[model samples]
Target: MIERVLAIRHDKIGDFVLYWPALFLLKSALPKASIEVFVAPAVQALAEACPYVDHVIVDTGDDKATSQKFIERNYDAVIVSCSEFRIYKMIRHLDSAYKLAPKHNWYQHLYKHTADAQYKQGEACWRGGCMLVEHFLTQHGIDIPELPQQYWDLSAERQKWRSYYGQEGNEKLIFIHAGTGGSSGSLSPSDFANLSTNISDKTQVDCKFVLTYSGAEEELAQQIFDQLSKKSIKVVMAKPLSSLADFAKSIVAADMFIAGSTGPLHLAGLHNIPTVGFYAGRRSAPIVRWQTLSHSDRRLSYTPPIGKRTGKNMSLIDFNAVEKDVVAYLDANYA
Candidate 1:
């Protein structure tokens, strides 16, 4: 009788988004249970927006206070989706009957249940997360069903942002984020500008582009804006929003999203919106490993070759080939 369950994934925005399916499956297995999550302060708003989560506790980086808060709740089960040594230290004190985590650290023996998130070359990060949850449930004599593609009903958020952005006459809105957030390799402003121009010129669909950025990325976004302006493409800079949750709401208005493997791209995945991602050509960060959480048919990805000169080089990814495939994707889906 796991009536109260707590899951912890206090980490990056992209990783949090990828872990949704695991949470979804957990809720499905224990429908009547009260499911809550502990998250990083940076993703508090986004975590609150998750339909699968009932409550979100923001880790203020104070281990004592945060642990005390959860300790009062007396959760029956705890699932550490993204395990950290710090997390283990705090939750180890929790009197929960069942605690599950991956078999990663030496301290993993602290967990009552530990499962191997069988690491393999070029596998999606979320697959391992799902394995952890499935393993925990099966050990408890609960049957786990196959996961369906996930989507959020953000219609109100969509309507609110679409009203603000103001689409004219059935134009398909495309949001392009040029900065990499220092997470992986990405294209130059010139490359993004040229690709946008090619899509506008070649695709049969009537498309409007919104250049999105925050912090230091403003310069990168502006450069692409200027280039597209000179090329006569229908483009505009996205209005700055107050928070990540607000930005995610704006993404709901977009028909498509494009970026390097980064936070904003995964925000679009929350809606299962069509996505185009540029991934680093490393074995650990392959196109498949970091693919957007969108469904298979909704995502298209590109990466440079895996080698010394090419692996981290975004310039080596053939943008011309990318442009052709993007144009074809747009025409097929939008036209």
Candidate 2:
């Protein structure tokens, strides 16, 4: 009956966010099933906030403790959303009837079944996770539907955040996140400053730029903040929150989000917020491959030219074109 299912994706925050769509499909397809998630400690808070999840098990990197947690649960199915050898060793001993993962590496054989969820040139990474879940359901004689769009009902949190920040009702909130998390190269401070200025000048609607940052990237964000302040733009640094979940709640109020491919950018995607992302031109991390988990109409991306010399080079992207397109999008939708 597949009464209990454990979906594992103990990876980076951004990748975990992308896996939400697949998680959505799983819960929708099997509503009666108790769906739990195993995630890294850093992602535990956000995982708990997910509407589709019933329980969240945080991987504390203590092998014996983690193994005990899994053994006690005795899941009916284990879907390794992001396959890893370490993960294989953790769950292989479980007596689950079905253990599914992508057809990758020799380690994949540890799972009871494998699906062709291999990454492709132009497919969103989430689709591979979707395929794995879909294959699992089909094998058990379950019918699944097309992927549905997702939204969060964060009205209370949004209102509290807006009130706390003194966000004016008339101003459109645009969050500009300058941190790249080192996953991909990002635009320079000057590029972000110019783009923010272009947006302010071109969009008819009143806009408030919120500069979001974490850790040592405070310098990067401050650089953009300073440049925009000199131009007399309405910009402020996003207030620090207690946790990643709280930060995500704050993002629910944003009318638009802009960042290089990073965790915060994907957190904005959780609300289906209109997102504009700067991506690496490399094949593995192209705009299409790591696209935010928003509806197609809500996402806009830019990247450098594709090649060894330019693929990961942020300077090679056309900031002018990006600025124009972003301004146009804001005018058409929000204005």
Candidate 3:
């Protein structure tokens, strides 16, 4: 009988967030099951806030930590969403009834049972995650079902975040993440400045842009704020967010979010926030791969023409086209 479960996905931001449906399935299959998430320390807060998760264990891939994670507790089942070889090796601790993981190599034999994630070259990431989760549940005699765009319950936090930011008025608030986090193309501050003004011109509703960035993005934010200053658009540099939780709160409080395919974009998707994401045209990193997993109608993904898949090649993403879509999306949804 499955009573306690461990779900592991010690990966990056978007990668970790993509496990929404799989996690949902785990809880659904075993509502009374004590579900714990094993994630990188980077996403501890986010995992903690997950309503389906009962506990959050920060898995740092060290030998000692792995032993402690495995030996310290008794799990009835184990699920691995991360493809790290070492992570698979640490499955020695799972003396459970079921161990569900994606079969990639000989190392996968470590798990008593496994599923094929069937990763295609340009597959939608969230779907692949769902497939693995579904494979596990079905193989274990559970049926798969539909899932929400995400599973975040931040009602209390939403109110608190709004009050903290102060409810100024009905002015639409669009959170813009201007800096690259080593994951996406670097849209220059000037490009964003232009986008802000273009959005203002395109949207019927009066909107304000809140520029949010990580610790390393301060200088980039400054440049964006300075550029926005050149225009009449009402723009504010968001107060420095201290953690991933704080960042999520800010997204909850915003009316819309704009960014490249980065962490906050996925965070915004988790809350079903309307988002316009800029993506590259590379086959490996196509729009379908990391498209924001928000409400289908609420998400807009824009990609450049297919060409060189290098960083410098990001400039090929037609900024003008993106601006047009942003305007149209807002007008269609909010207008």
Candidate with top TM-score is 1
The backbone clash count of each candidate, in order, is 0, 0, 0
lDDT of 3 by residue, 245-322 (tens): 767756788778888647888888888888887776665675667777687788777666666654246566677787
- Candidate 3 residue pairs that clash: none
What tens-digit string does per-residue lDDT give for candidate 1 at 1-335?
88889999988888888888888888888888888999988889988888788888998889999899889989999988778888988888889999998888787887778999865776777788889889988898999977766557787677667767767777888899988953557789998898889899999999899998988898999999999999889999986899888888788899889897478887898788999888888766657777777888888888889877788898989888888888888999889
Clashes of 3: 0
Candidate 3 residue runs with Cα over 4 Å from true position: 119-122, 155-160, 309-312
Per-candidate Cα lDDT values, in order, are 0.85, 0.84, 0.76
Ranking by TM-score: 1, 2, 3
TM-score of each model, paired residue for residue: 0.95, 0.94, 0.91
**What's the distance in Å from true for residue 131, model 2?**
0.7
Candidate 2 TM-score, C-alpha based: 0.94
